[model samples]
Target: MSDAPTTTESNPYLRDPDVQLMLRAKAGDDAAFSELVANYQSRLVSILSNLVYSQETAEDLAQDVFMRIYRSKNGYQPTAKFSTWMFRIANNLASNARRSAGRRKEVQMAGGDSSGVQTGNAGEYLVKEKSALMPARQLDKSEMQGIVLSAMEGLNERQKMAVLLHKFEDMSYADIAETMELTVPAVKSLLTRARENLRTQLESYFK
Candidate 1:
């Protein structure tokens, strides 16, 4: 009659559907593995594209992420949301790529899209406070998108990653902290500074 909760009871992420799919993947279910890939491929590519600033590079990195996941399937653990685990891999890969490259450069978006990512709700999030940033005049969608992309570029790598996870993934601060391997408070501070930096950059465009 112990009152303590079991591991599964304690970790609610274990109940996530993606985690169940991954568990099946770990059990050598080929279809399950494919399903996981299908589920996350676009999201992975989109996030990676923004991180690396190149569509081609993003695609390659995304493939690498899947490969890594496949190879590590036997050891898969449901410690967090599957997306959080996946993005942790992505964040590391992007950081390593940047370190090896040793320079930042602008790359054109695929299909003329600003920010070079799927950017789910990110544009909307950016303009939620539009009045403050563009007091002089109203910007059309294209113009606002370009400014948002530029503002995103102003952030450092960590801040950009945090913001992307927050806005695009709609991840909680706790999940983001785990994905980024930072404390919760640190993630909060990082996101706060990221928003401030973005606001400053966007305001400069109107000024």
Candidate 2:
């Protein structure tokens, strides 16, 4: 869906060992498929946990991602890195889950959850505390993390995802663009805005 120029050089992923493993799995190698699953299981869960804000739901979604990949293995190609393809699926799955959750109009918010993400209800409380947080230097590590999480909660879903992918995953603009189905310029703009929002939300902490 990106309007940006697509890469014309041979995809670097074609030489990736993981892509080769996936190709083997595509050829009906069950063990190869299992290896791929094992390799990505933890990573998928980690990313999805941040996206959905629930460890349990993240695990379920990760399983769903693998299932979809397995079912579509027949059509698999090495046009991109295995990780890129995997995260693209994760990003889409997370977006769909958010939309579905939004339709219900009621979401439970739990504090001190294993996942650092905050749900809609959680964010409701955060808006009330926007006056100011204690200075960042005085807070402990846990408190700082909470502040960051609270700041992240203020971002809209797309901005949050863009921040997570760019900051946590260390993905390039092009990589993030591919994963989120946005143009490179859009991805850049999203991250810029997200960072500004984060700074504004955490202004007290930064000082």
Candidate 3:
């Protein structure tokens, strides 16, 4: 079947066929590749922006991530949805970024994170509940963004990945497992622990 997705359609977002686009990318479709980039670049930027904190650094890191994706296109496999696989790569890159910073502090001096911004009487976890309702429900975009990033910074890398892909992206357990290379049960366990920890971090906000 040629293993390539034909990009006859101008806006794949209307089609929303990521798997098709990825297959096309695997088959060396530059237009398909550009479509993939256009669809995910902003999302990648938002995620990395929160993790890295510096806008400039996030941009560079995002570019590197896409470069990695480009490099990996030849070997791309559709084990999970394109989004899940992409986020797995993203989570890995973000963690490496933290490590590469060489700023190891005993969880006591996690700077620039600021433990997230409090919008109101809601605790950190509670604020998340509200943010989850709608992108433009009752909060400003920047405020919601800060909360998401700060909350993520506090989570363990694995937990953060699980939460980000699931809570933010609404991925399924099966998909998350495949993307993270964990068993389905393992992803569930990770989510459970992640929720608990976030709730704890958020408890202070409510208090």
Candidate 4:
């Protein structure tokens, strides 16, 4: 009943993974670079979409990320994980975009709720929030989504980035700290507070 092509959860580069590919790519293996792009393109786009709305802008930024990677291949070291490095660049680009522009409004199919992600309705129930969020009312799927995004939007720049990377990008505290140029404990504390704040804001609706 669907026309979409089936996608497999395969990454051929996993044998050598991203870092190895980058090394070969630096040695002028065009195929290796292409493989790296194929491996990470989806993740890059998904991460960017969480921050920006325009697909065009996301594509441009994604290309720039890769370009920087290629340019820096000679000096690159695997001190941090490949993903951490990739997202560090992504976070920088995203932060700069936010500073230069206003909020981007677009429906995101990534990171809001998937794979144990909280839902607006609990266990297949359709609950609707009262008009204007009247006290003690329920929240539907869209309302819940809006509430999460809005609550996240209100966080200070660093907190927002912390939440986005931790909760959505699934980065570790160490990786996040490295990306944001913060201490590990600081990243942990920030995420703990961000989660608590979001939970407090959405508790009534969630239950």
lDDT top scorer:
1
Error of 3 at 85 (Å): 2.0
Residues 48-105 of candidate 2 have per-residue lDDT tens digits of 7666666667888889899998998888867777878888999888888777665443
* Residue-by-residue lDDT tens digits, candidate 4, 1-207: 112222222433233367678768868898998998998888787556545544446677789899988888766655555777788898897777655443221223433422311212221221222333335433455556566666665566688778877776788888899888899999988888888887887788758
RMSD of 2: 7.6
Q: TM-scores for all candidates? A: 0.76, 0.77, 0.64, 0.67
lDDT tens readout by residue for model 1, 142-166: 4767577767877898999999999
The total of clashing pairs for model 4 equals: 0
lDDT of 3 by residue, 72-103 (tens): 88876544457776777777777777775644
Candidate 2 stretches with Cα past 4 Å from truth are 1-11, 106-139
The residue pairs found clashing in candidate 2 are none
Off by over 4 Å in 1: 1-7, 103-140, 204-207
- What C-alpha lDDT does candidate 3 achieve relative to the native structure? 0.67
Q: What is the lDDT of residue 64 in candidate 2?
A: 87
Query: How does each model score on lDDT?
Result: 0.77, 0.74, 0.67, 0.66
Clashes of each: 0, 0, 2, 0
Full ranking by TM-score: 2, 1, 4, 3
Q: What's model 2's overall lDDT?
A: 0.74
Candidate 4, superposed: residue stretches over 4 Å from native: 1-16, 102-143
